[model samples]
Target: MKFKAQLHNNTVLYRIAQSLAKLGKTAVVQLSQEFIKFIYLGESEASFQLFAPIYMKNIFVDYNIQSAHDNTIYMEFQVDNLIKVLKSAQGNETIAVRLLRKQKKPYLTFKISGYSRSGRTVLIVQDIPVRVLTPVQMSHIREPVVPQAQVNILLPPINNLRSVAERIKSVGQCITISASNTGKIKFHVASEIVDIEVFYRDLINPILPNTKEFESDQIYQNHLERYFSCTISTKNFVKFLYAHYIVPASISCVLIENHAIIFTVYVTTTAIGAHFEDQGNACGALTYYIPAFAL
Candidate 1:
């Protein structure tokens, strides 16, 4: 079995590895003709999945997979080790990765080549045993009922969010996020002695799908302008904010009452000189699901 690919954007690869490392040490990577995916889980049973569609031009110079019978290749590797190697990338370098099976052992070789006069570096990492996880059926999970009270608001830049979270994290074990239909979102934390609320106003509220369903519900309609709040662990929430180093084009917050608060990060590779204006241009999405804390 042989698999190789040339990655056009080293920064994107580095960022993805770094983000995954923050969630878990190991991840299952799937390489096929259609897309490349990295899957892992975090706290609160939250799962993080990264997808790089093969259809994107300039993303992958060459993706070849040759196996005995199957066209897909599944492998497991330490995310932190990969991130350490990828950290050496100077943002403009191209990454080449090749997988080989030697003596019944899998090895991954990474080559980082700089664009300027800087020389190239090659590193070979021997992969541990691959453990394939059984795929979970989405239909098995209970879908949050429609007309559920949810507030969709655009998040501030990642750096800003992280900085704010760092300050308020120490004050409370969990952070409360509250949103109102009047175009306002608040990050609040309250202790026995003190209370803190950071308000972000004048932000655009994304149009939720099936608005008519929510409108017909009297409970949600009456409190439509009232604040809807959800609490999530401070530690886990801070970790999710660290993905800002990847410089996602946009991050949106969706708070579902009695459900989960989901952050959808649209990842685009700036190393390729491509500006992602909308979801259509995004190479992948890094979504963080933080289950709501019981009130």
Candidate 2:
């Protein structure tokens, strides 16, 4: 087995690791000729899941992966350490990630190269130990599936939403998120003595393409005025906000009404434009599935 890839976008690589570090210390990585996946396969006791796959064509100028095991390699490594090393990378540096065997142990190494202030070339190598996962170990892991979203709306800047959500977290245990196909969304919190709500109007309510799985009444096209609301743990919701550090070009939410909220955080720039429905998913997206809080 052999794997070595050069990542030109250091910022994206750093952001991906930072977000995963929020939930746990380690994460699973899958590498193939097509794309490299950075996954956070939520804990058994929790329902949060993250799937971040970056195609080599988009982010890597140099890509190589050769494995007798179906041309793919799966490994798990410490995300906390990965983020700490990535933090040292500067804007001008290129990170070459590779899988290495040292002293009979597996390791994921990041060799960063760039020029220093004195015009001399600088090299920094960060070796992160990893455990190569076998086929059986990763067999059952998969992305979550839910019913077609009832309302799909583009979110405001995550920094703004995160700030508000963090404050609300101090006074509430759960937050009720309500949305409609009419370009409106509301975040409401209530207690025995307080009821507070933050509302946004005239937001972009993207027209979701008709899917065969969507029922006649559940489709947003026909129910523009209907609202779908779900209450989710305030803590978990705030944790999801940390992804804003990646500086997403845009963030969109698919509300399944009382079921789950799937956020599509676009890592690529200009994800959705004039032809939003056509171009919204043209590039890779970081998929986050946060289950609704059960009463």
Candidate 3:
């Protein structure tokens, strides 16, 4: 009368186990994606009776409890095997019934021995839901919101610095890059950084008008960014690039705002006095153009 289910990945299965030790009648159970049907007959002949199927198909009649503590029956049907049998023999009752009764295939073996009033019975089942994991492999997820005015972007590499830079450049935007003190590098984007973030959100969380469901990562990388730009304070920008890109701490201060983002990186061999190298470590600036469109 009572059931519990276990789910892993896309597969799910449920079982109704017996609690009382005294009852020993064999239980018969049938299950499908939509429902589970159980039967508890007083005799083997009654279990195989003509009305068994009809009673099962509409068995949610009335019950004080889904399963009485000491009077409930349980069934475990082999889900896959049952589906195969049912689908292949939709109208072939003789073969289906024979297989159900004779074959010892791995299946939902019903264990139906419950004590109930002479004319009273119980049945219980529920629908199980399944969810598929999104198959997205994108590295960055975008956030919504954009600014109306121009925004400056200062980016330092966290990992794979060059690869990240290359991806951004591929957006066909012009980017100005330069070496700075220690081992830091910087990039600048001209568009409002907020707008870029909004674009990224759309790319990462695409909406489908038809199904009203988010699109699966399986479809395609609809809008991967070839480039990005961020604005950072000079000091933090140095740390950001160093920590993320694995660049040394000596590099600092990239000037990254104009018509394009520019970096005047002062690469230094030593941490000390690196920020104040020859004439205050003012390296030549590198400029890159920002792309007009989002990936």
Candidate 4:
């Protein structure tokens, strides 16, 4: 197997690592010719899953992956370690990722090149050990599949939502979110003595894309007057906000009534100095979905 990618936007990759670091400790990196996926599946008490995939053209200028396992490779590593090394980069640095093996053990290495303050060139190499997944192990992992969402409302700025969620966390263990085709989203928290609410009105309700998962009959065209709501743990909601540490190109709220809440983050992947890539057809790059029952 061979894997390598030249980083076109180092900040995007670093923020991804940071987002994953807050949700779970380990993730499966799926490397294919078309995409690089950072996936986290629920086990034990996790009750949540993260699916983040970058379009090959957006981040990797020079990308290659070859494997006998149908041209894809899967590896598991510690998210904290990945974030620690990535934090060493100072925004001006250039970073590249590759795979290597030693003594039958695999490692994912980052090669960072930068200039020092003293007018000197410096290259930093950081290697984190990883567990390569066999074909059998890979077959058992799958992304979560959900039915069509009842409401998909374009969200207010994530930072504003995060700030509200954090403050509401003190009033209750769970936060209730209500959204509708009315172009409004309201978050409510209730305690014995206090009931607090934050509302974002007049926001746009983006046109839902036509996909197999959402058939023509399943769209929310008739529900413009109704509100779909779900309650999830405030702690988990706050953690999900970490994904927006960097401003998103687009972020939307998706609710399946009493079932789940899915936050789709379309990262701002405009390559520095380049025009904004048309992401109209691209699926949400990062999906953070939490089941209501899990909390």
How well is each residue in 149-227 modelled by candidate 4, as lDDT tens digits?
Answer: 8788877777787788767878988888898877888898899998998988898777543455444544544456477
Overall lDDT per candidate, in order of appearance: 0.66, 0.79, 0.26, 0.76
In candidate 2, how many Å is residue 26 off?
A: 1.6
lDDT of 3 by residue, 1-295 (tens): 3332321101111111111001223334433223333333223221111101112222221212233433223343323443333233222212211112224332222222222456444322222121111213111211112233122222332344444544454342444443221233344434445211111111111111233233764322221212323333222222223222213222223232222222222222221112223424421111111212212
TM-score of candidate 1 to 2 decimals: 0.78
- How much is 156 displaced in model 3, in angstroms? 2.5
Candidate 4, superposed: residue stretches over 4 Å from native? 44-46, 91-96, 118-120, 208-222, 271-278, 281-284
* Residues forming the 10-long window of minimal summed lDDT in candidate 3: 12-21
Model 3: residues with Cα > 4 Å off, grouped in runs = 1-155, 158-160, 175-257, 270-295
Note each model's CA RMSD in angstroms: 4.6, 3.5, 27.9, 4.4
The positional error of residue 247 in candidate 1, measured at the CA in angstroms, is 1.5
Cα deviation at 61, candidate 2, in Å, is 2.4
Put down candidate 2 lDDT per residue, 136-205, tens digits, no spaces: 8888888876888888998877888987886788777889999988889999988887888999888898
- Candidate 3 root-mean-square deviation in Å: 27.9
Better of 3 and 4 by lDDT: 4
lDDT of 1 by residue, 251-281 (tens): 7778886566777777665632122247677
Global CA lDDT of candidate 1, please?
0.66
